[model samples]
Target: MNTRPGLSDTEPAPCLRIGLLWHSVNSPNLGVGALTISNIAIMEKVANELGVSVEFIVLGWMDKSFPVYVQAPNVRALALNGRACKPGGAFSAAVGDCDLVLDIGAGDSFADIYGWRRFLYLAYTKWLVKRAGRPLVLSPQTLGPFKNRLARAIAAFLIRRSDLVFARDRMSVDYARDIGVSRKIIETTDVAFRLPYEKPSPWPGPKEKTVVGINISALLYQGGYTRDNMFQLSIDFPALMDRLLDYFAGIPDCEVVLVPHVLSHRAVEDDLSVCQQVQRAHPGVSVAPAFRSPSEAKSFIAGLDFFIGARMHACIAALSTGVPVAPLAYSRKFMGLFYALDYRDVIDCAAETTESALEAVTLAFGRRDELARMARHSAALAQDRLGIYEDGIKDFLASRIPNRRPAPVAAKSRLSA
Candidate 1:
């Protein structure tokens, strides 16, 4: 970890430098984009409290399907993928220039499930940061389902090296310990809980109808990246989707809108493409216009009366906004996160048959009001959980960055003074 000499009686430094790893505001996967936007907001809040201006360097890859949103003067976005991660490259200089490096593993890429290419890409960058002697913090995220001994060994090493580690759910916490991570682990909620958004000015869906927003993940729809039932799910995804659309159509005064979260350019990976196909098949269903930013997508999602999503962050967008959601989960991350918040409305594709899954969703729809009430409560709890994460961040920054101003003393209260 890098440190600066104390200012003694002098005021704090003019700028605090931070390097964000494995994050980009331009990712086609809006889930990663949401993490980027929300993290910046959180850092800004803490910076205000410390009475300091922050100069952030966002070091990550860029996806051509999306436009860059980190255009703020305080933030410098650098695409550091491929050969750019070497010692003398921009990635190294960025780490050297910053006071701290915080890695989120793009929220879940720390594991080997994505294959060696991605694992190496993420791991090598962390190695660069450490070799540069910069302090690294692993922000709250799903740590791993490593599955391979070597991958688990590497993950455990990184967890051990990080100055501060945070796991966003109980399962991640348990996994961290299982991997021999001895550091004190703080359990916190996802940062997306605090993502800022504006409500849609005018409701886009049909008025006086139950507006249901559905997010379909093209990756899952195509059966993982291979399009050969890669995840080995017992239920048929295409059939399930068809059934959902037809079933929702049967309800009187109900409208369904397809909300695509991943706007990848590749046809198989792009959610909007699948959504367009759904629109073609069911002419009554509407597909949302492509959003320019994560906030925009979340804003549109927030306006929905009810939401069912395959994308974890899209579901998060709904949950954090107090809009009730039923998550069509295919991963442990979903079950861990939702169940941790005690708002269990996740319909798992692995465990239940299509009929059983639909039954659960149907029951949840009937109890949407109750779900909404629980969602409101859970949102509050999410913030409360985030306080632990916030405090850890504050303590880390305060220790490294000197204060610009003195703490104010409180005035004594009087009964009638």
Candidate 2:
């Protein structure tokens, strides 16, 4: 492992300079987008505590410019024009100057056709690490089933070279070990654990007896599977929707909210489409507006009595906010998250989803007290895991940057407090 030697204990620097490499900058996908935002926020806190300056190097064209609210004194977003030009050199250039570099890998399902490499972020990061002397830390990320031999070989090489590697699930930890990632590897939770949950919007009418929330991504429903398979999923989804409406319609106080997790032009499992169709079929259920920010989406979900979702982040948002969630998994990442949070009993993906979802929702509602207990447990566990992630970054930097001072106490207080 080649390490840089600018910041040593004898001559410590005032602040550590960090470069963050992320694939989706302006994406509307709530899970990935929220992860990027939350990761930046967490790093900002970490940086402040350490008196570090952080620069986010986003690698794509965004529908909108960088968000103004995310701009702060310690962080800066650098758009690398990833769409029009290759970002390998630019990523290398950015990493070369920083004390440390953090790369967020595509969680599990790395070999899927719609996996992370398809976006070119990993490829660029690999190149950047090869050219730069700074130590690299692979954050708590999901590993792939690795269908592509070439991509897998490259990923294996990168993992082998990283100073520190943290897998988000046991499966990923096992996979990384199998792939020869022999360095310091640890199991940790997703960084989104640090996000603060807000209360949901007030209901326009009297509160319903049960407010069921459902979130889905059209992209997953569109690709990976065959046309026949997708058609089946589409047909089955609507049928399931009807069954749910009929089951809850007679309850009088029950309502449904359909949340579209990703609202982009290319999105295919259109949550809006599902919401519209269900609304038209069942006139009584009311759907909430499409949410754009993580705070808004999470707040809306926080109000639900129960949440059912195909998107992992949607389920995460609900769970993080103390709302009971039954995830409809499309990939291993979903199952990994559920298992990590000890919510395995509640997960049901599209392949396995059926009338059973309705049953799960009912069961979850019945066990609200138990689920609440589990929620607190999961939150504490998530907090402890985040500490591991923070420590991993600190250790990686300390090993490489000799003069790196301990993160400033006042900055750390302001961010973490």
Candidate 3:
């Protein structure tokens, strides 16, 4: 095993080369879509402290029309165009000369339909590493229930062979254990926790009234969950926005702002549709424009009296800033995050949503003091857990790649020798 001076080590060090692997560049919610971006941002800071050089390899098909480039210093972005690189070619191009390969999970939207294609990407990467006989580390990632047997087998095989495994939650830890992945398995929080907090909103407005914020995703509508027959739910969100305006109508000074987390694709359009419906219902309700940076989004969320959203990161942004949040969970990640934070009481999604969302807001208002306390505690917990992830990455590198020279002896000891 190799050893190097990481942040945890008590010695100075040489620069290290690190490779980051991810699937896509564009994301509707900058928080969710730019997870790799967040990871790289944190690593850049850590690497600078530890004297390491970092390079990013984004593995997926490239659209020449929409070339994506990571905009960070000392970081090079490699786009392995899908057609030419394929899985094998992408893996080789990404990890060929790197000292350590950090395998971030692939596009999660594909997993929504129980698609096996996501597993194929992971399996192929592992195959490449084994073929080259190099070390590969699995970062804090979300594993699947594996609806397809072939996908499950492939995932299991890869998990078993990885040099290191760090699950983002307890559920992932259990899943890996169940599949007989006996490698090092540790639980850590999402890497996004390390991202810098966004500043407060600059716009001046009445500071007394509670500002209710909602981040809606269009994916729900497209997935048929919005249809009355499919989900047996009648919350025509656009219409419901009107009802909410009516509900809050007489409350003096209270205002509503609909924030769209996804600003592009069908999801963005869906969010816009909901916004338009709300605007039609109540002509005066103010709506914020799509935010471009995670910092700006976080800052906006921090000023909210309360937040309700289908997107996980929207809620996370609120929580990260000490604002009370109620998530309209559309996927397991939503439930997983709440459970990880031990805030299952705050989430209301799909069938469980409805008036409960209103009730949660009321509770958030009533228990504002308690919620603030909990938020402070949870934020600290998030910070500590993130430290574990940072330490884990450095330790993995130190153990897998030893330092070239041994520790120096004291001058007195050397003289005796």
Candidate 4:
């Protein structure tokens, strides 16, 4: 691995510079947006405590400019013109100067399930950072079920190069082990747990009845609702939704609200479109308006009495607020995160049949009280897990550069004669 000239632990640098390499900050997925904001907050808090001048560099010149909720003077967001990732390019120059490089990998795309192109992009970024002689940290991310050797090789190389790696769930940690990542492997909860909750104005769901939030993902909806994924749960999702709607409708004081997490402009990738279809098909089902930020979306989720969602982050929002959530999980990430919370009511869409999915949902609905209590406990636990991440971050920073001054101590009081 290439080494860079960084400040020694004994040397106090007046300024600390970090480069964040991952998906663009502007993301249509609210969950992605939430992660970006939460990460910045985490670093900012550590920087303030260390009493060092901190600066941040984020990749720019993306096809889409998603909204970011940061206004810190210390942080600078710059766009790399074109694909200037090659040496001597503007992008390379910008990141090369930074003291550290942190790859968030958009939280979960460390695997090759998406495609080799996505996997390669991340691997190349790691090589770039290593070449720059900066310490690289892999933030809380899901590793993978690499079906191909090439994907595994790329992932393994990145893991080996990383100075520190944080896996949000045990499954990811195990995967990292499988890839031969032996050191700097730490388990930490998702940063979304720390995102500030902003209460929505004029909440859309009915106040008179028990509000049940149901988020539908465009990914599954577009995939023809099949069981071809890593978890092969045979399901006809539309029918499952109908059955769920029927059950909720029978409850005298319960209301069902369709929450769309992804609002892609493409019809096939937009949850709002699928939600509209469900709204028209079901009499009692209501649809929520598209939210502008993750804060607004999570605020709406916080108000729900119960939540069942396909989007992991939407379910996370509910869980973080102590509102019980049952995830209709198609990925292992859900199983891993929910397991950490000790949440039992999950519909493993990849592993179970439609009938089993329905049974799981019904069981979750019947046990809302138990789930709510567990959620509260989990929320507390989530906070504690975040402490591990904070500690790791502070330790990493302290090793590079220690605080210049120690806090002043007060003189002892003199005793009266």
- Winner by TM-score: 1
Cα lDDT tens digits for candidate 1, 5-106: 554435444467779898885888888878887777788778667555576788888876567865665677788776678778988988998889889889
Report the C-alpha displacement of residue 394, candidate 3, in angstroms.
1.0
Residue pairs with clashing backbones, model 1:
none
On residues 18-113, what C-alpha lDDT tens digit does candidate 3 reach at each position? 566653454444554446666766665565444544445555433343334344433455654345345456457557666667776742332323
Q: lDDT: which candidate is best?
A: 1
lDDT of 4 by residue, 1-417 (tens): 112245455444456777877734555677766776677778777876665656677753232534554445555665544367667676678777787877787777777776676666667767878887889898887778676887887788878878988888888888878877676688988988887886545546757778898898766765632324423446877678888888889999998899988776756557888899889989678998887677778888988889999989899999999888989987788888878868767788877878889888888888899999999998899889888998898898877754333213211111110
RMSD of each: 6.7, 5.3, 7.9, 8.0
Model 4 — TM-score against the truth? 0.86
Q: List candidate 1 stretches off by more than 4 Å.
A: 1-13, 200-207, 403-417
Clashing pairs in 4: 4-133, 26-66, 60-79, 231-350, 233-350
- For model 3, the stretches where C-alpha displacement exceeds 4 angstroms are 1-15, 23-26, 60-69, 87-91, 106-114, 179-182, 201-206, 224-246, 267-273, 348-358, 400-417
Give the CA lDDT, 0 to 100, for residue 28 in model 3: 44
Ranking by lDDT: 1, 4, 2, 3
lDDT of each: 0.83, 0.63, 0.60, 0.75
Superposed Cα deviation of residue 111, candidate 4 (Å): 0.4
What lDDT score is found at residue 290 in candidate 4? 82
Is candidate 2 or 4 superior in lDDT? 4
